[model samples]
Every structure is written in structure tokens, then in C-alpha cells.
Target: MSIEEPMRKTEQEIMPARASQITKPLGYDIYPYYSLGDNKIFNGYSSLCDFIIEQKTVVIDGYVGVYWNKLITALKEDLIDRGYALNLIESKNYLKSQAQLNEMIAPFLGTEGSVWGTKTTLTLADYFNMPALTEIEKSTSADINIITGCGASLSDWKAALIYVDLPKNEIQHRMSAGSICNLGLDLQKEQTEMYKCFYFVDWVVLNNHKKALINDIDIFVDAQWEDSINWAYGKDIRKGLEKMSSSVFRARPWFAPGAWGGQWMKEHMPQLDRNEVNYAWSFELIAPENGIVFESSSFLLEVSFDALMFAQNKNVLGVHAAKFGDEFPIRFDFLDTFDGGNLSIQCHPSLKYIQREFGENITQDETYYILDCKDDAKVYLGFQDNINPTEFRDTLEKSNLYNEEIDIEKYVQVHQAKKHDLFLIPNGTVHSAGAENLVLEISATPYIFTFKMYDWVRLDLNGKPRPINIDHAFKNLDFNRKGATVKQELIIKPSILFEDNDFICYHLPTHKEHFYDVHRLEFEAEVEVETNNVCHVLMLVEGAAITVESADGAIMTFPFAETFVIPAAAGSYKMINKGSERAKVIKAFLK
Candidate 1:
């Protein structure tokens, strides 16, 4: 098939009759927020200034991508109008020069041609001139001494600290629009370079800084909006996090369009923008890129997911806390290729390679759970029986360089895909989901290390040739996983683990390389489950809706296609089907 040719409509293109029964709005909440109870969430510059004027000394620190100039200008105007003298100390003045920062981070950023980079070991403090900050801390003379910027807390001033947080998705949006630059840098680069900096250097430093400051913050601000802001007391946010740690919660999901995007999400998800060509990916719960939202009456505030982990890693992760720390070990996302092109033929880095090359603690071990697919849908996986490494590499390289077609089936195995089937893809295995499939990608948290070997001679959405990592793919591809071995080891078969009159639990075994296991609980009425001291990540795959009642009797309704979490501290819970049909929920937990 030519890359530019339109895809033929398949049975999967027709929405299922059951899909009409899903009358509920998009199960994925774009603004999912937790209640702040009686605590008030302040809004607007006037309210912010009203609180700030009362404090003697204040430090307004924020994440990268926040509009520091706009925030400072609004605060100054509001505070001055209220007759308060302000001594503003901008933290950017104390930052190391851009040249110095670039030199320091260059080693972590691989090269101009590659997208991969090593995680940075540098801290926010390392970007500032500590002596200058110390001198400024001693010279605070105005009535309200305020220090503000990305690392304003580094001033060491005994002040009421307010952290302004922007969600990761919003940061990426701002980066794409060329509205923001990396921390300590004044100029914005191309979107890819900026994203590389964020993934490897900027986010790493700021996340560590945020973790260190979590305990001391007095207020938390949501700076996602341009004209308004929502903020709550830090203690109140902490209390909300504590409540969530011991109960059930869902991270707000965001969707994006891609070159090989599909129409599944655009058609089924009513709230999505249909004007886009297609929806390619939904970030269901990729911890590093997702955020938890909190609400107080009509107002909403959001904080990065790591804030919850920093505050209560033990309660959220239970026994696994010691090993994983604040890092959420598992990730859930949606890859919709229904009526779309095939995903790039790719492989992920092995455990040792990921750790050594990228400084990630875990490899991108993955599994594709076929949520929905057409009758003719397929998945490219493993290798052919007589695969030649040299020939395969040469063909892929020549195809990329000459826009020539290579018979992918000659080098890779293709398997028929069906609904509810799970395919294990441990690192080092070559894999790709073919067209006409809505794949639920469950994997380890490290998601950005894909090494693409072939892309079917297609250009990206930007009209540019996508990066092909034939060399990296060759190093990581496991040639031994060929033909019969691929079917024997990678295609998982489910077995009934437990059964009763109302419910049955089926175990879908994962690869040994995966530290997590999967269970599908199908129930007609209600099913009781135990956390067993390990957190559970779940998605309602089969039914329209189900109610999850935690041990404390707190209940939350999750519609079909919604992803949620049950913290380990929740102990036991019950899943009650709220729809006419039986409910099938996928549960992933630490092995």
C-alpha cells in the first residue's frame, strides 16, 4: 500500500452497537479534579495580591513554562494599587549564563541528529549563583520582599513559599507554540530540541526541586490559564493528596493527533476535537506527563502527579515504595490505529542499555491489549524464521534513504489481532501495531526510548522524514525471538484464576522481564478485590460503566475506556457493574 493512499474502511470503522449504549460523556475527563472541601481556592490577581500583601516575605517559585513576567507584572500592579511597597527579586538574575548551562547539559543531550538524551544529574541549585542569592536574602528592605522565578526558593529567604505549577501537557503546548524556553535559557529552540531538553534536563532538575520543596510550600497555584489562576493552601492540597492516597483516583487524560493517527478516539470520544485529522494517542496515565486536578466548589486547581508521590509514595505504592521511590513504575496509554496507518516498526532498549544510555531505572517493557480491532487487523512482532540481521539493517537503511519499499513481512512476523488479546513485548523485541486497531499500551514508565527501524516510507505530520534508528534497533533487536518462539513466548493465553457465581478473574501472564502482572475481572453483579499491599492500575474495557467502592465506602463511577488507580492503602474494594452487560476490567499490579 502506498503511504499517501486512503485506508479502506473495515468492520471496526463502524462503531459497535454497544458504543451507542455508552451515553455517558467521554470517560476520559480533561479536567478531573478532587474536592478541596471547606478550604477556599483563591482566583485572579486581586485575590492573589490580597493574600500576598499580608505576608512579610514571600517567594513565588514556579515550574518552567510559567509566564514569570506576566505573573510578576500583575502582582506588582495589584499590590501597588493596594498601597503595599514591594521589593521584587527576580531569580533569573542569579542564574548561570546560557552558555554555561548549555555546556553543562550538552553531554546529556546526545547530538543534533538524535532525539535521545541521558537524564541529567544536575539540580536547580546548580543553575544559580548561590553567593548572589545569599547576598539578596540579606538585603530585603521593602515591606513585602518577594523573590519570584523558576527557582526563586533557592534564595534561602525565610518566606511563605508559593509554588506555581503548570501541567506537563500545557508545557509541551507552550513549547510547541514557541511561547516558552527551557529553564536558565532565554531563547526558544525548535520544538524537538526543546522537548529533548525538557525530557532530559529541565524536567529532571525541576521535579527534584519540587520534591524537595513539597513539604515547605505554603500555597499551590495552577497557572495553566493566561487570564486567571487558581490556588489553594499548601496544607489543604496536602490533605487532599493524603485523602487520595488512601482511596481511588484518576489522572486527567489528554489526547494528541499524530501522523499515523486514527479516528477511533475522535469518533467515540465526543468531547475530542473532530476537526483534527485523527487522534493518535491518549495519555491515560503516564505519570511524568499527567497531573491530578483538585476542585473547590466551582474552581479547579491542578498539580503534577509527582506532587502526590512526593507527599505519600509509601501510601500510594505500598511495599513497592522502597524500590521505586516516587516513580510510578507502570504506565497506561492508548494507541489508536483504527482506520489509520501502521505505527513505525520499532524496538525498545533493554534494561541494562536503558539504564546505562538513558539513566532510566526501568526499560520500556510493553504489552498491547487489543481493546478493539477489525477482523483483518494485525500486529507486526518478533522476526521471521530465517531473519538476517545484516540484510534487514541494509534494507531498512536503503528504504529510508531511497524512499523504496521493503517487504517488512520478510524480516518480521505478523500476527492476527483480536479484541481482548494481549501481546507481550519485552524490551529488545521488535513490534508494531498494524492499522485498524485500538491498542491499549500497558508498559513500564519509561516511554520515550523507541528506536524506529521502518516507517513505511511516510513523512511525519510536519511533512518531514521521521528519524529512523536502524543502528539502535539492530543493537537492541533480539533475533532469537523468531517464528515459532514468537508465538510460544509472546502471545499470552488467559486462564481463570478464580470464579464465583457473580464474578470470574482471569490471569493474563506477562513476560518475565515485566515486573507487573495483569488480571481481567469479569462480573455480572459485584466483585470484591484485595489490594494485597500493591497498587492497582485499572481500566474498564468491556462495560459501559462500573462503580469502584473503596474500603472506606467512598465510591467513584468509571465509564468504559476510563483509566483509574486504586492505591495500595485502599486495602479492599468492590467493583459493581452499573451497566446491563457484564463488566470486564483490566487490573495491573506489581508482580
Candidate 2:
């Protein structure tokens, strides 16, 4: 059944030198950045109170899982000190019944893995009843009328808007800490609601200026960065905020635990709360849930990653802004299964299937770049040459019905994994990384359209069986990706592109269906690269460190396995190898 049992015929000759041979540079933990505290914020709550009290009707909207009571308390305390009569209206009480909320989310809920699918397919505004706005208005008739909720709006009257925003991770943390409570809301559903809220907020800030203008708004309170909240006001505040994020930006990473999670992150990411069972996913650059951290001298301010894109999409994304508008089209994440089990055997939906069924614009075309792996590590990909469509479907169905383990070796081809091996996973290709591997997943923006055919016969962390998607997976699975064809196409053999004393660039070929390409630069001293109207995402895959110096003289140092982006406007930048030994950097950009 296996065309090439070892996958690579001459693997021993092509394997890179052991990564342990490389020496890590001193003080290379990505610049040793510090967390900025409360005093660094430009404007405080008092300033927001002063600015908002000057207006008539104010609408304070926020993310779904925000602590509205705490925010209202802060605002009320500030306004009370100034001798102002304020009537605060809460939005949760205006929400429809639990039955209505359940009905609205039913379309997005189904069994996928051990966890249930909890994405909110509809808009946030659709979750509210029109009559609730009347109730909110009826209760607000004091010296200052302020309405607050996730669904708060300025549609009724010409009111000053105040958006109370929080980072996605912070909200997730609060949910985990039981500070923000929704009875039946799981983490997946909570995240989906917040992401949809982000879409709504981004659209409003970018397109509907007169209705809920960002610049004309009374205030914007961001509580994601520091222990204390940040408030920015004034007519030119948008310009100032844009300037704050104009130079360098990094999104706050969010981590989650899963059944097949590993111990690598729990051991390395000391900043994370290590008490969790195991850390599975580190959402580094998924902008909807990610937040941008702005570091100042005394303090650091943070806001949702989309906020900057909403305000300065043209400046941040450069040329691609016109094509994608508010959408950021690249994603980088970690899939660490070191000392753990294999991932579920899965295939992503095709472009037509994803758009028609899931309402996504792009398919999940992915690649796995092995950052680190053990000697026995392997990856399951493609299919056996002897696979039969009818038998495969019948076996999968019988396994689901009888709760039996799958004979994976007979159905899927396995490949030996090594450090820096690039595996192309186009849509409809069956793939999964085996145990003892630290995989850096660089792929298209879409992340959640995976149709898993089989999971090992083990219950989820919750002691429930994972759902098998045989029918849906069969519809999108490419049966032609088997035997020798898979070896020739799915696996990449890097070809020498450019070589010199300073650097040697190798082209990691991607599938023809992939719009992006990857290149690895092995350098001794330094090298300069240009961005020809497309953004480049950089990752320090090997060695200790590398420093990327922009044309404007901004130097950003990256440690091992750190990811960063260079905008198209960056023009030309020099990457200096900071380690004593040779360094390897992977560059992914549009073709």
C-alpha cells in the first residue's frame, strides 16, 4: 500500500545538521521587552468622563463577554465626583430569552471533535430584539443618558459613541476565571461571538463614520493592555492612535489546551499560566482574536489587532489594503505535539465547498514547517495506494457506529519528519502531524474549516467520543492524492535558489494551487531583502537570533521560533545574523 515506506529515498543525505549544533546568542529572548503599566496611557477615565459629560446622548458598546458592570462602575464613580447626574442602562437585561439565543446559535452548533462547535454564524446585532432599544431609551432620561451593552447603537439619535474594547485573550481569561458569566457559553462559542463583534466594530469604524464615528466619537476606552484602562479623546485622537501603531506592532498571543496538546509550551512559555493541563494552540497572528501591544517609555497600551487595521489599513497593509480592505490575509501559529499523541486525520474544505457551506471567502491551504522533532517523529499524509473509496467509507462508518480504533497504517502514508522539513497541505489533502514534533503552521487566513475523518479511539479530555465526519469529508477529499503522486507533489524538496558567502537562499516549493511561496535563508553575517509590493512574514526557524532592520532604522530582533511581519511599504530591509553560528530564517510572501 505504501509507495515509499520511508517517504524519502535519500533522506539520510538531505537531512539538515542537528539543530542542537547551533549556539544560541546571548540576550536573544526577542528584545527582552517589558510589560507597560497603567500610567503609560495617554488619557485616563477622568478625561473620558469630562469629555462624555459634555455630550447629550451617549452609546457605550463593547465586546460580548466584557465586564460591563465594572466599566459602568468606573464611569459612574468618575461622573459622580464631578457632580453629574448620570443614568446608566445595562444591555444584558435587554437581551432576548435563552430560547431565542439558543435558536440563533443552532445553525453554528454541531459535534465536531470532543468539543461541540460553538461558532456564531450570525451578526451580533441580530441577537437583539428591536423593542429592547425602546426599553433602553425609556430608562435613560437624566442629566446624562448613557446606554451600555454589546448591542448598543447610535441608530436612534445623533449620539456620541464610546466603544469600550478589550483584548480577545483577556476576555478568554476572564471567562476561564469565572469573572464574566454566561451560563451555557463555552470557550468556542465565546470566541466566535467576540470575533463576530470584531467584524461589526471594524465595519462601523471604517465605513459608518457619521453613525458611530471613530474620530468624532467622544471617547474610546481600551482595557486590554494594562491593569488599568486607557482612554483616548479629542478630534485628532485617531491620528494620534494611528501614529502610535505606525512603526512596529506585535499581537498578544492567546493559548489554549487540547486533548492532544504537548508540554513544550508549558515548559517554555513561562509568561503563560502553566497550571493548565496542557497548552495546545498559540494563536499568534489570527488578527480577529489577537490584540496589538503598543509600548511606550513608562507604560504599554494594547487594543484589538483589528482596531489599528480599521484605523490605518492603508498604512499598515499598504498595497493589499485596496484588495482586501479590512482583512489581514496571512496566519502563523504553533502546533506542538511533542511528547503527545497524533493530531486527528483531517482535510480542509475546497474553495467552492468552503464558500458555499461555511461562508468563507478563502480555503484553508496550509503547510507544516517542522521546527523541532524527535528521532522517531513522523507525519501522516495522503493515502495508501491500495485505498478503496467504498471500503474506506464503510470502515469509517463502522468505526463510528461500533466505537472502534482505525487501522491508520493501512489507510494513510507516513513520512519521517525532520527539522525544517516543509510539508505542503493543499485543500482536500489528508494530513496530520504525529507525536514529538513542534510544528510551525504557516498558512492562509482561514483556520476553522477542517473536516476530520478519524481520531484515534480515545475519548476527549471531557470523556466524550469525537464526532467522525465521513460523509462531509468524503465529499471534499481528493482520492487521487495517493501513492507515488503524493510523494512527488505533497512533499517539498527545497532547491537552491541563491548562494553566497553572506547567505544561501533555498526555494521551498509550494503547490501550484497555493498563492504564497516560502524561501529559507541560511546566512552567516547579514543579508538584505526587498518586498516587491507584497508583504513578507519572517520566522527565525534555526540558530539563536536574527535582527531585521527596517529602512527607517527600526531594528527588531527575533529569537528562536519567533514570527514577525514586514509590510509591503517596508521596501528594503537588512536581516543581520545575531548568532555566532549560522542562522536560518523562513520568508513567506505572495508569489
User: TM per model?
Assistant: 0.95, 0.82
lDDT of 1 by residue, 359-385 (tens): 999999999999999999999999999
Candidate 2 structure quality by residue, lDDT tens digits, 555-587: 777777777777776677888888888999998
lDDT at 525, model 1 = 91
With candidate 1 superimposed using the best TM-score fit, by how many Å does residue 220's alpha carbon deviate from the native?
0.2
lDDT of 2 at 310: 67
Task: For model 1, give the 10-residue run with minimal summed lDDT.
Answer: 8-17
The TM-score obtained by model 2 is 0.82
Off by over 4 Å in 2: 1-47, 53-57, 91-143, 155-159, 175-218, 224-228, 234-248
What lDDT score goes with residue 324 in model 2?
70
RMSD of each: 6.2, 9.7
**What stretches of model 1 exceed 4 Å from their correct place?**
1-28, 138-141
